[model samples]
Target: MKKIIKTTLVLLITITTISCGNKSEKKEADSKKIEQTEEQQHSSSENSIQLNNGNPWMANIETTQGIANMKKLMDNFSKKENSEAYTQLKSSLEKEFGTIITACTMEGESHNQLHNYLVPMKDYFEGLASKDILKCKKTYNELNKHLAEYSTYFK
Candidate 1:
């Protein structure tokens, strides 16, 4: 009877050890799964920041080119000092800037991130129509500064 009781106690201990090991293995697996899920969420957020087609830098280059073209148009008007032509040119510039703002604002990714650049651009153009030559020149410089910073994000 003593020998039988000893054997039963040993068997119970072995069974408990095996059961505890399985529980520990299951806990480890659950922890790993949670970690993988978190990593996937992080990756998706990063992907969203990237432009569609995975070439966000290209958009920045294009935006810079557009700003350069606008500056050139403004320079020509400034050089000519033709009030009538300047008036029309200024109006066109405002419209183009408005379109750019609308497009940028409509974008899903990085819209808020880009608002600092776009808002100043809009404000500068809004004042262009009535600005004197000196004010226009100042605003042009300001616009160029903002565009330069904006372009750097792409680079």
Candidate 2:
């Protein structure tokens, strides 16, 4: 009797586990509703010219590339050199900045401030390569100032 009871219990458990994998129609409908809600939350920037904080270069690359990566690199900067992060940053900068610069007129009002911010970013990478921690920190500060100026004017 005990053996029969154990066998029946195991069979019941197995059936229950197998049934759990199957989604009810209600569960499937709920999932579809969640997906639809998520799709509606995104913004549609139509004919929009976004500034890089305040630069005439139209758009924020930082957000697109996700500033979290930059924040991570900066936080771990002194530990060891990250050539991969450096390379990725440079590549993203080129694509984003190139698109921005190309879209604007050469004589745009915020061109100098915007361009100045871009140049030192490369300098920061160079400083990293040469192990000039002080110089790299200083360059970051300078870049910060440039960006502040950009924000003041273009926005």
Candidate 3:
């Protein structure tokens, strides 16, 4: 299922690019979709948490708010029979994942490496959001191992 989702997303992105006519136009469109300056890219949030400085798409997820929200969402995900809440949280997480990857696209070869790392995390996040506590715990542990690596290379 995870593989399917990843494959589909890759195909969709490819199709979208093909539909857009050319690579340069797609890059322009993706960038122009969020028009932020380099300074705005890494602006500190109210909590003084910095987002990814390399891409505008990372502004929301790399912040303190994003981390806090993810924690809260994971906590809520453990509740029994909370279908409605899971629905909302899952949607939000998926949207944020999109933002993260789109930001990756702005960086060329780095995008490929980042995409490789993030894809599995995205799958785990989806699993957690689906209210699978065991999966969530396992994924969280997996994420901890990768966090340092992400920080080291992404900057």
TM, every model: 0.44, 0.34, 0.39
Candidate 3 lowest-lDDT run of ten? 42-51
Candidate 3 residues 54-123, lDDT tens each? Answer: 5423322343244345545555555434545555656766676565545433355444445555656666
- RMSD (Cα, Å) for all candidates, in order, is 13.4, 14.7, 20.6
Better of 1 and 3 by TM-score: 1
- Model 1 weakest lDDT span, ten residues long: 47-56
- Off-target runs (Cα >4 Å) in candidate 3 are 1-88, 144-148
Candidate 3 positional error at 83, Å:
7.9
Q: How close is candidate 1 to the true structure, as a TM-score?
A: 0.44
> What would the per-residue lDDT of candidate 2 be over residues 1-155, giving only the tens digit for each residue?
99999999999999987777565666898999998877665422321334556444542444323333444444444433444444454455445555555554534534554454455456655543444545545554554454444434343
lDDT, candidate 3, at 3: 100
For model 2, the stretches where C-alpha displacement exceeds 4 angstroms are 1-84, 106-130
Summed over model 3, clashes come to: 0
- In candidate 3, list every pair of residues with a backbone clash: none
Ranked by lDDT, the better of candidates 2 and 3 is 3
Lowest lDDT sum, 10 consecutive residues, model 2, at: 41-50
What is the C-alpha lDDT profile of model 1 across 35-148, one tens digit per residue? 999999986664433333544343444445556667666565654343344457667777666555555423444554354345556667654554476665566666666655
